[model samples]
Target: MFKDTNQEDYGSTRVEKDSIGEKKIAADSYYGINSIRARENFNISRENVHPELIRSIAVIKQAAAATNYELGLLEEGKKDAILEACSEIINSNVAEELKLDAFQGGAGTSTNMLVNEIAANRALEILGHKKGDYHIIHPNDDLNKGQSTNDVYPTALRIAVLKLLVPLTESVSKLQSALQAKEKEFSSIIKLGRTQLQDAVPITLGQEFSAYAEAVNRDRWRLYKITDRLKKINLGGTAVGTGLNTSHSYIFKIAKQLRNFSGLSLSHSENMIDITQNMDIFVEVSGLLKAAAVNLNKIASDLRLLASGPAGGIGEIRLPAVQAGSSIMPGKVNPVICEMINQLSIEVICCDQAITMAARDGQLELNAFGPLIASKILKSLEMMKNGIDKFVDKCIKGIEVNQDRCQQILDNSLAVITSLVPYIGYDQASILAREVRESDKTLRELIVEKNIFSKSELEEILKIENMTSPGRKK
Candidate 1:
């Protein structure tokens, strides 16, 4: 989306060449020869490369230009033009020029070249040259100098992953905060608690929500900590992380340039070959995301159980009615939000398996599955963040408790006898519980009539405040 201020006329088709042969692409296209070949070869995955990965590659190109210019390997004009082109990619939708398929094969070489080619043509335009004038500034020579797909793609992928994680963690934090708010609001409401779909004991709704909050908080921190290893990159490791064909000064200086350009606290990996050869870092990230998804699935299942029915089921809490749940079943409402979350969580867990298989199947020099890994991980993060945000805004924030339903269930259930166990022995409490479940008399009547506890004592013991934690003033 650039205006031809230089007023150069363009033709319909232009010829471009690589090691294999020459191919004709659109004269107006910003993508170059390798992109043409890649577009033809890897058309299976129609999905465009992740936008954040494109931005990250552009960032690495800027850093490379700066470092090359400092080392006197690149001309000042070329460096400035490349920087301008990369800035355009980063700060604008000019990154849409990177149109190669995300699921490209073999360690993302096509995707890397596509970024380099896009920057080259855009820079050529900035310098008043035609689109495909590689004589002045070439994609591989100038734009991709001192880097290889091995180092550059993984480094950019890491940068992209770190960038994408910000919103996801924020979403998790919001969910945790919302649950905690519910915890405080429902602190006084006593409800039935179940284990294996059977009544277990009495628990305040606040306590249930508090447990949910704690689980989410743990997942947030789990994602936060596993990303530390990702900050170490192998930028200078050219083809196989050995720093071959690159100077020692270049190897050491690229990290600082990358940090300055990307604004991330990055460092050089102590062993570049190891980082390049093994993609365990990505596997670790995916596993943590799976943990988060598992927690969310459990929480969603709980909400659905608590909000099961208005008259026929548990009916302890009421979910927000965000949509018409049925087309023909008049006045039917369902827990669609929680159901959607359940589906999303299952998808994320499956994606983790894909990422794991990608990591596990890599060979000695480099992992050829970077493209798949990047695409899946980035999509998972985005889905999770958006799902959590919607769940909070549409479901959690608007939920209401069926207080009367909860109280009725608490009064009729045998779970309340657990609180009386410490006062009367477990054997006697069990007998009273069985009798109440079978006979028409309530627990209060059965306990008082059996002379185990008087009416006043029964009333004091079964008070809502005394049912939970001990030592409260009546």
Candidate 2:
């Protein structure tokens, strides 16, 4: 119905008909009727489903085909054709053929159909048949035998997410190691610590960086452990978590084949209905992602504040200047890398919110929101991995502590009074602090003027090592 007389409009069009009607698709295109309808119906995201997701679905089809052939359901020639087609998809970079929007309705029905159609047509070509000649290797009858979209979509997403998490954990570990290196680098540089944004006490910059490193270490562990929860899949559940047309043997044997194909220790869901109906595991994973984002955001904000200025602001640490910050301000550089991390964290947090809400809004038997959840979760994982790597390379590794600035600020600030309070008493120290703040004199000048302690005694009390340690330096 959407076709024009000019066949060149669709680049040599072929008529592919579905129950809804028929439309003209590219003659040489692997995608068929369902894909054409989806392209016309859903152009929301305008971005293709991720390549990993497509490849993951191909693995599912390949494994399913092998299982079916073993069970005496699929013929040998059809199985071989499907295997070769799926293998080419996994190894080659022909993701363009599976052109469906990542974010769409029907709970990934269109995506499942797109994959089925592409695989079926590819298998047809392998068996010396033209596209749309699905009579030989039908999309649903052969390629999707004993499977449903509800089962296939979530299984593919789990596989893709598991593959995605490997690099994410590695990037987080690298970020933690980078922070640890900085912690050791700044271990001896004592700086003024702030509580509620006011001068409170003295602490080494190393201690602060240690806190960051420990936070990131926790994030790494959290991301690493969540794979177990994702390993359980409702693949054989069919329509409503009942085996439906699928045999019990097929239900049990598919997991082994899938594990072999994907190289993951995947297991079948104990309660397929629950796994299919309730999507809480994804929400749990998103919660951990939110935590990781929170940590990255906090660290990035602190780095930007610490690297505020070379002349004004805190100026305690210098970040690597990677670009010109402003057009009008001369010789100015901003914390672009840290800001990038902050922005990425914000987006990850937003993606998590969408995932949580979509998961919660699932209907009676199906979520109908798998597309949203999958896209957000996968995007969050990918961006976090990329952002953390960039942050480690451009910012954390290049950070240089301003030892002179730290010493100068501590020399003039009132935080050092905490160090002297033990010997001078809290009342005397409070009085000295108040007087120094009110008057123009520095803490050192006031202490020397009042003879609170002798000059040598004050110097000894205010030593960087002594001030930063506790309980009389052990």
Pairs in clash, predicted candidate 1: none
CA lDDT, every model vs. true structure: 0.88, 0.87
lDDT of 1 by residue, 211-279 (tens): 999999999998888778889999999999999879889987889999999999999998999988988
After the best TM-score superposition of candidate 1, give how far the Cα of residue 104 lies from its true spot, in angstroms.
1.8
Model 2 CA lDDT for position 235: 87
Which ten residues in a row are the worst by lDDT in model 2?
1-10
**What RMSD value applies to candidate 1?**
2.9
Worst 10 residues of 1 by lDDT: 2-11
